[model samples]
Target: MFDFVRRHNRILQFILLLLIVPSFVVFGIQGYNKYSEGRNHVARVDGQDISQSDWDAAHRNQVERMRAQMPGVDVKMFDTPEIRQRVLEDLVRERVVFAAARDLHLSPTEERLDRLFKTDPQFAGLRNPDGSVRKELLAAQGMNSALFAQRLSQDLAMRQVLSAIGLSAFAPESVARAAVDAFYQRREIRVQRFDAREQLGRVQVGDADLQAYYDDPRNAARFQAPESVTMEYLVLDLPAVERGISVPEDDLRKYYGENASRYEQPQERRASHILVKAEAGGPADARARAKARAEALLAEVKKNPAGFADLARKNSDDPGSAAKGGDLDWFSRGAMVKSFEEAVFALKKGEISGVVESDFGYHVIQLTDVRGGERRGFESVRAEIEAEVRKSLAQKRFAETAEQFTNLVEQEDSLKPVAERLHLTLRRVEGFTRGFQPKEAKAEDAAVLASPKLAELVFQSETLAGKHNSQATEIGASQMVAVHVSAHQPARKQALADVREAVKAAVTQARAAQAARTEGEARLAQWKARAPDAASLPAAVTLSRARSQDLPKALVDAVLKAPAEKLPAWVGVDLGGDGYAVVMIEKVLPADVADTGPIDKVRQQYAAMWAGAESEAYLAALRKRYKVEITGKAKAAEEPAGAASK
Candidate 1:
């Protein structure tokens, strides 16, 4: 039986076993690295040793992920020393985070593990009704329930630890409110551009200067074109197999019979409450005393005909609705705390409950109403049931039809004959770019373009349209199409006329920049003559001033690039689109400004920020203390195939 299962699909069997094994480490930075002799130690966070084997394996995984994103990326692209170092840094950080999480005692719950294993889309159709892990899929993913649970638990624990650390640091309300208001108030600006057409006509470019400017490599960069291509193609329509399959009444009835419980919803109730909180400037045993007083008040209210509202207003500690006589608008079960919910459920309509203690405080609840939780009558939900039944039938039939189509395409090597036999029309399209949108293309065509594989195939120069190729790929549910390329037009550089305005703008900007540079240098020389030293420099055509808070972005850019001692030196900057400016720094300030704002708010934001940095430093110190050693040689030996793939 084991051999038979393995023979069914080795890849899936291995995955199932792997899932049973443990959660694989997922760290950024991966590549292929071969040790000429023995494993080398990479880095030590505190004393934790990073092994070369683990680093190499993790790096290989990163390369695989990148290839999956852009399949044509060369393996050599990730072979640089910088790339390897980056991968090492990422691995070190991950180890630190993992070690810290373990120290903090964070863990994933059984419920969360179950959610992770079952809620995956791959297992959507595999689960049993009671929510137990599916046996077949568990075997397929190479994961038993226990192994999956363990791995899931660890991953979740790590996430919880990170979340706790991240949420510990929060921007102040002043910052949050400012960010929120900015987010809300942000508008797409549509600037009415001031045309330079009249002024540009008055300007003349000397032929010699124009030719010299055009010859400059920097000026020529703007005219460079991206490589493009067009391709001919044939698409097989395997998805249409579902359309060809028939849904019988017996199949629908069988599905409905087996899954009857899914069509039902459990019953629930609604109630309201008046709460007298325990600790509102009360005695030492405030909660107990409040509950006792609430009990007495509950009895009094029940006895009084119209005094329930008056009593609630006088005694309820809930400030939100105390003015409305402690009225808690309607709420369903699970909406209230456990103790309060239990009390509310136990009561009948118009019945008053005894004092109940909940996390909030002492509560006196009055049952308001109850509603049916059972499935609605069949007549009211007939249409819905029919749709559900139809979907089930469709899925079952589609599976069989898909298998047939797969066999047909694999054996026949053509979709034309199949389309003819099925009495379906074959469509042809004119020459189109891989990402092009044609007027004749439908929504489904857009979906095809959206697929990475289909898009790749469309752009692949090797894929010829007219000859037999792979069958039509399924882009979605309930839709199938087979297409043949009627013509092909290889991508070409666009005409200069198509980008004339852009070229003109680029040329104008170049001229403006040259003018700004010439003018700035002349002004700087005049200022330098008067000052003799940078310290003596004063307000002049070349001098511009900026404060810490109001530093002009152009000025900041120039200062950042200049020598530290030359900070206040005037520098010229191009602000794009033919704009330019000369700027200088007036002052420099430390990041921490004690009197800038409210001390309390500043303290709150800064403490959290500093704490995270402290935590990171602390973890690094701990790794150094523990002397964690990663066996690089052992890691490489474990996944040689992955390295080879990279």
Candidate 2:
């Protein structure tokens, strides 16, 4: 409990602040802090205050990471309240975890930090050509050697704490084996259902009954339609703009000529060589021996330059291309190391180059075939260019048309007049509630449903009273809508006759559920009172073997979630219609039969759970360790209670 409280301390603070302060006070604080403090601080864990800087940085980092992952995310995507809340919660969680780590007094050693830094793929992949870590990458992630070391230490410490608690609390073999067996075991059910569709034809209603049913307050609600609007509007299309603009053939030709390289494939060569490194150190005699071996290989390559490919496979330090007869597959200029690229590009066709020195040591090169490249002709790509030109024209035309529509709507003061003049079609919609779809509107009818402004206008009382012109809304680039209220009908109650069957069925379900609960409870109570009377166990309560987790998913969930120490708790839940269940946890068999397999598996599962728990506790402990305060508007700025609970 304490740990949980600690983990959610920031949330708790916000909740308390909201519950204690007035809304206007909260608003005032927010306004004052917005200008004075610059950014309204949400909360502080331990001594480290969580400022707007922290929030913004966290949010930006999250968005950037998401952008990296999705590649096509737009700025508008981040504008939603849901996204904002998520970002805020993540920032809060980070502070909580950091605070907890501080409270634990757990730190990683220098050696561990060094190992992490050197081995982490992200850091390792950012190394310079000479095999040194990049300064910029480290700086971007907000880490120096010391901060990175601390991060590693915190990670290690948290893992240690979690493992200690979770691993030590492993379930017994009897517990795990039973759980696994019960879960993996399957049962087939033969089911039959009397569906409403099948009975609907049999459910007949006379004229008088139907009219009576429709008059019923409860039944009448079914006929209540969502608010709707009818609209007439103009649309501008992108294709129209594209058609009006033109790019000359001369210009296209000039573009192709100036950028000829873009159309030409680079020339590539396949070559291979034996690498003998001078960097391999040894005793004086060993060094001399290696040098002599390299010299002998050099002499052999010189003797038969064509044999270089065969020699490379037999002896080359470059494992990347050692197979396939040491063939370094076709590579363009700048594809190879500077030394290698220069050497290979300089060699004449079919000529073997002298030994070349590079980071990989010395390499004798074979000049393989250099396939000359070619530039593509314009005729082959003319169609593609033409299509591009056409699309561009269309887009431009669409924008102009849209602007003209907007101007017409602004001047004429009514969408109906403009639409009629332009010979555009007028559409009428019905059966729409406040949020319901208009009768004739489809999801793709962006002109009607997509505009936020039009949606508001359609719903306004003045518009319903027929005072204002229809609303003009933009759903797509070239699609616009004008919506006006046609008819208004407020919600009404359904008559009892209209919903008589439904009411009867509902009442029957409630009665049946009550009956089941009453019977189940009585039976359960009787069994509890008659201790050790195995024969007295209700015959209706069938005997079955079930692991702790093997009970009905819903049943197990309800049982485990309760205060288990105070077990023998009874719970009743409605199971559709009048069906209901009342469950009684008869007993809890003690855990027995400890074994490594079960313990290890259970330990792994619990490790994750315990770590989260401990992290939470550690955070609370930190608050006590360091007096932290969040005051005024910042406190009220938190998400709603229960909003971030999940």
Candidate 3:
């Protein structure tokens, strides 16, 4: 066989090529095309496509970040199409700014990056005393020092691009003054109000008017009942699971024993120290001098323990505590540097210690007080232990239970079967609408209904038409809900007989308001033709945007907007159901220039407005320059939670 194969090597190679090339052509090209189609580009920036998967990942990251920050908040509140669109826009903006930075050679220098990390308060937790990156802190955020530095540098460069436009904004004194003067300009006006309530007795509305009002197409929505459903749902949440879980007394005790330290309050020490100014890693001479100075303070404290505070106040280099007699107050383990903690813990109450060296400097320590370091007994924390154990068990069991719950809900036609199988409560709610919160709903039910996902599932065509169990929807972390809509009521206009009283009230109010407006207009005309005596009108009051003088906004607006160039101007304002007003503009007054504070504030506001506008314009220009295109069709705007169901 070996001899034969060696003889046919060339022919075998040709045969292998024929087979391999065909497979590559047949399968590999199709696989490549499928991969390309899977990308599903939704946006493009600087000719770089942003695929749907990328957008989803970015939005998921943002949602998770927000969830971590505010665990108690409902994730559904921010997980909307609008919020996702904003995230995509932000991603596009970031890409555009990054491209601009690269093109303009605006990369931040190493020195600037280091300076920012050390000086910026936001990064204080991520820096060591010597201004080095805290690798552990970065690791907690799922990034290494290198990655953090890269991100920080990029952010700084992008900020520089926007800051250039923002900082260049300036509002000249003249421009600022004109705007401020116009905004604050006051008008002295006398208003005569025709209260609708007073005119209600005079206005007449009968059955005919009520019927007409109810029959009007424009008023149909007012008499219509919103679409609603009566649903029975099964909630499989961590809390519900925990409620059913019962931890044995022995198990609780075992958990308590295993985690005894958690129930034990750590010992806290209150101490004062005279800190000498010198870095531990400073020159040998400086460190030595700091140690000597601390030793001298320690000796003085030993000689006169009562006068230690006075000496600390006078000589301590720690400015934070220098004025307060060098008091560091109460601190537990892991709160202070290792050397300082060790030194403080070693001391007896009211005992003074020799010089201790730490990252900041050397310190002469004195322990003034000690507290805590107590372990709670079994009976004292038994309830707490049981709750903890139950919650832990529920968390572990939730995934499996959730799977079963989902499967059972889908396999079965109703939620009752799943509820029974999972030993969960089958709760029922009547008149549950898509976005409406029942006035008498419990807190738990309200929170459940607040989930747009759950509402959407309940109103889905299949679920509504078939009256079957909806899919298990995740309303929150570790919270799944499956609802069965038992009864659905479509929206319909109420019969005129059913809504007669409401229609009658509406007609009466409309007639009264109109009557008031008519009288006000007639009075305004008469007052304009011949100026009424000052005694007949209400006392003149100054009005401005800043000060409404207890007048209705409509009246104030009408008074201020009337031909104020001519004094004693007359204007009529309809105040809706409240009534109407005839305002007499007595005089026009310029802004108070005497108050420099207001003028300065106006200038600052103007500058801020100008800067914001400039920044937005610049961003628009950048978008144009990058040829940014968003191809994703925006989802229809969703009604907010607790809004009208219709």
Candidate 4:
């Protein structure tokens, strides 16, 4: 958290813009409805509605993140009440932070935000090679400068509030030491098998027991199906539309002649530098020393220009380039820091600079190579021009035809007229649930089936009761899908007759597990009372905390944490669904911790963790102070009072 928060802090102070490394994922929310009045909202925070569209975007992003981490994760992993609740809780927490920032009257000036946009390396990916930020790029990234500043200011304000709240937070040295020891400590134990399978005959789970357990209303949800929708949507496939669009030979030739700069290459410059590293926020004396060292090196390079590479190899602080004699390779303008780029670009081929100052410190730079800009011939870029012209004509045709498609769909009784007019297919998908994500990463079919917002158009009160056409929904920039419900499958609980066998098996397994635990406890008690014997008590195997994979994880955890006043200590643990284990702790080995070095870093980490906890508590208090009404079925765990209690 500390590393991420302070990563881009050299010559920039806004940790909020850098993004707080929260305990859970915080998805980027788009289509923010500032005047979220009477909208379909999953949650209402501080009288501001978090619109359903924004929530869906955030939820999809969370799912994408999970999929990225666990490539082979089953669809059922996210088909739970817990994942939904967690996403809502994170959004609510963010809202709480924003509200707190507002109440505290915290806001930064526009000048500061604009300055950050220009200087921050975090936005480097969003910028062009010319060091300019375009409006088109901003919109493509789903962040306009105004909206970014608005959201970023609140985040910065939240950062201020958190820092203030956590000023007094600190973790004791003892606590840190104890935690380290507990983590590194190891123990070993040999297990005596008391298999639940062997004890299964003891559990006589009759039909009456199974029926009684299944009859309970509390178990009804375990047998219930999640809410799902089966939709019939008419798609205006973009690829299909583009294929139908024809490009004339004359248009392609004209396009190439007009947009000649698209095929032109920019001038490139390559330079190498021996760097003297110094942190911008560090002591001035250190910065001065680093600059002086860079100057001396610059003098030496100027005195013997032929031995520049040798000097860089021996003296450069940049590890990435030092081994290659400070070779940065080829780069264009705006590739380096403003000062370094300007100095390098200004120099002629083989020219060397005296010294240059940047956020990283001082640099003794030498220009190695320069390539002049040139434009490609029309013949060379003819194919590229043809493709662009084709797309341009296709988009223009799509824009004009989309409106007509929408009007026809709305006026006509059925989709046949629109399908006939557009020569497109009217497809129907059954059992379309939000949980139906695609196995393939690049598959496009799942997005259509899993869109809850569009599915709502078919499943809502009016649409479900009667057959009606939905509004033309834009699937992408060049495609629109209009959907209608053909059939409905309302969520219902599983009938007892259907789940009778399942209930019986569950009851039998549970009974067997309980019986095994009870019998193991009794046998362990008898063994502890008498002298240690091979037939009754097995000799303890030596194990350490680091390597305890041979034994059951539950048993290993019990042994490691088990208090030991004597040579052997025993503790019984019920390993859920796997019967019980009686772990005998034979030896306790703790980690050797010193007052300094790694221990000091551990102390700092603990303090930061404590501070984070304090900030969470403060945010919880703010949530209670505000009237936050969440419309969905998630618990109010983000509430100030509930959060504090937790």
What lDDT does candidate 2 reach at residue 43?
58
Q: For residues 70-179, could you state the per-residue lDDT of candidate 4 as single tens digits?
A: 66765446645677777777777777776676677877787877676678887664455775654454453356766556666655676776778687777788998787
For each candidate, the alpha-carbon lDDT, in order, equals 0.54, 0.53, 0.79, 0.70
For 1-646, candidate 2 gives per-residue lDDT tens digits of 4554455444433322222111111112223224324445665544444566555555565565556446675654675556655665554444444444445666677776666656755444444565554555445444455543444455565455445554455545565556544333322111112223333334444556555545666755565433344533344345434545567898678767776787786788877666776563446575555556666787898888767777888887678776766678788888888998899999977777766766656677777778857777898776666667668666656656666666666666556776665555555555543444444555555444545545555555555555445445565556665555555555444455556666555444444554554555565465446533433332223112244323355444554443434444445443433233445544444333232245567546545555566656765564465555544132333332222211
The sequence of per-residue lDDT tens digits that candidate 3 reaches over residues 1-646 is 4554455444333322222221221112223234324466888878776777767766766665566556677776777788889978877777677678778888789998889889977666456799897665445445577766666666567778889989888888899998888877888888889988888888889888888888788998899887788888888899888887898888888988999999888899999999998975689998888888888888889899999899999999999998989999999999999999999999999999988888999899889999999999999999988888889999999999898888999999988778777788888888777676767778987788777777777777677765578888898889999988888777678788888888988999999999998899999889889998988888888788888878787777777667777777888899999888988888888876643247667789889988999999999999999999999754745644323334
C-alpha TM-scores of all predictions: 0.48, 0.49, 0.64, 0.51
Strongest candidate by lDDT:
3
Worst 10 residues of 2 by lDDT: 20-29
At residue 94, give the lDDT of candidate 1. Answer: 63
Give the Å shift of residue 25 in candidate 2: 12
- Report the candidate with higher TM-score, 2 versus 3: 3
Which residue pairs show backbone clashes in model 3? none
Best by TM-score: 3
- What candidate 4 gets wrong by more than 4 Å, as runs, is 1-186, 193-210, 246-390, 437-442, 475-477, 531-561, 592-597, 606-646
lDDT score of residue 614 within candidate 2: 68
Segments in model 2 whose C-alpha atoms lie over 4 Å from true places? 1-223, 230-248, 278-302, 333-335, 370-372, 387-402, 412-454, 457-572, 575-578, 588-646
RMSD of each: 14.7, 12.7, 13.7, 14.2
Better candidate number, 1 or 2, judged by lDDT: 1
